[model samples]
Target: MSNIESLLPHLGEDDRANFMKAVGSIGAAFAARTTIEADPQVIAALPQVRDHVLSGGGVELDMSAALDALKEEPSISNQLIAAEVKVAEVSKIQSDTANMSRIEKMNYARERGLDRPRDDVASTMTMNEHAAVLAGLSPVQRMNYARRHGLV
Candidate 1:
């Protein structure tokens, strides 16, 4: 606040009020975005969400808190932009292409394996299949099963 205040007189012909308003708005949005991202579940869900962000589609999120934030510190743009970035994270049906550069979009496309089927069950035995089959076992039970199958 002091920094902005010091600059206000030097802004000269610039609208000081508008400058303050813009600064406050940016602050609010960053705060709100930080709040939403603190949850481990949200972080865990991101890979899927990035798909939506990559595609230029909207994700429905509750923005009432963000709206109320403008009354205090930051602007709505950061909140919205942050949300769009989040949106691209989870939904396989979408991606946040609007916010991405062409190079980034192309990189995403390349890394996403456009040719691979989304559901690819292996025709051969895989470690992932072992994990799924073993998921319900207690440690002792898993050991017993492994020994029984000559897999220990």
Candidate 2:
């Protein structure tokens, strides 16, 4: 299957694109020059970045060049710096998109009458109704409810 084909089921177009971009960035970084011993932190972050890039099809870069860039930062190693920058950006993008996708999936489930509460045999509410119920609660209350229900 194509990279986005499988991911498409899990993400919307925008999110999928961002995710792919993040993944591509990592791939480029991986392909770029790198020195394993230059910075341990950078070394550690490289794999994570690369994983995102390869999965997302974002960019193709010379891994050796990336490594060299990291090595340039002698203080903490450019690897770590690059890794941090890449990961932070990608992670934020991933999380936001994932949350949106989750909302969509949840809404879809509700639309299909698939999110019926186990305890309420007659409470087959629509997505809107479920959303209403959630909207009525405060953020703290929601957190408490989720915690109580083991959803957190």
* Winner by TM-score: 2
Instruction: Please provide TM-scores, in order, for all candidate models, with all chains considered together.
Output: 0.20, 0.21
Which candidate leads the pack in lDDT? 2
Poorest lDDT segment (10 consecutive residues) of candidate 1 = 39-48
Per-residue error for 118 in candidate 2, Å, reads 69
User: Residue 52 in candidate 1 has what lDDT?
Assistant: 25
- Model 2 over residues 1-152: C-alpha lDDT tens digits? 24333444576666556555544554445445342344333443444334444445445434555555555556546556767787797676566457567778667556754554345344555656656766889999877655444344
- Positional deviation of 4 in candidate 2, in angstroms? 8.9
Report the CA-based lDDT of candidate 1 relative to the real structure: 0.46
Q: Count clashing residue pairs per candidate.
A: 24, 21
Cα miss at 15, model 1 (Å)? Answer: 2.4
Give the Cα lDDT of each candidate. Answer: 0.46, 0.53
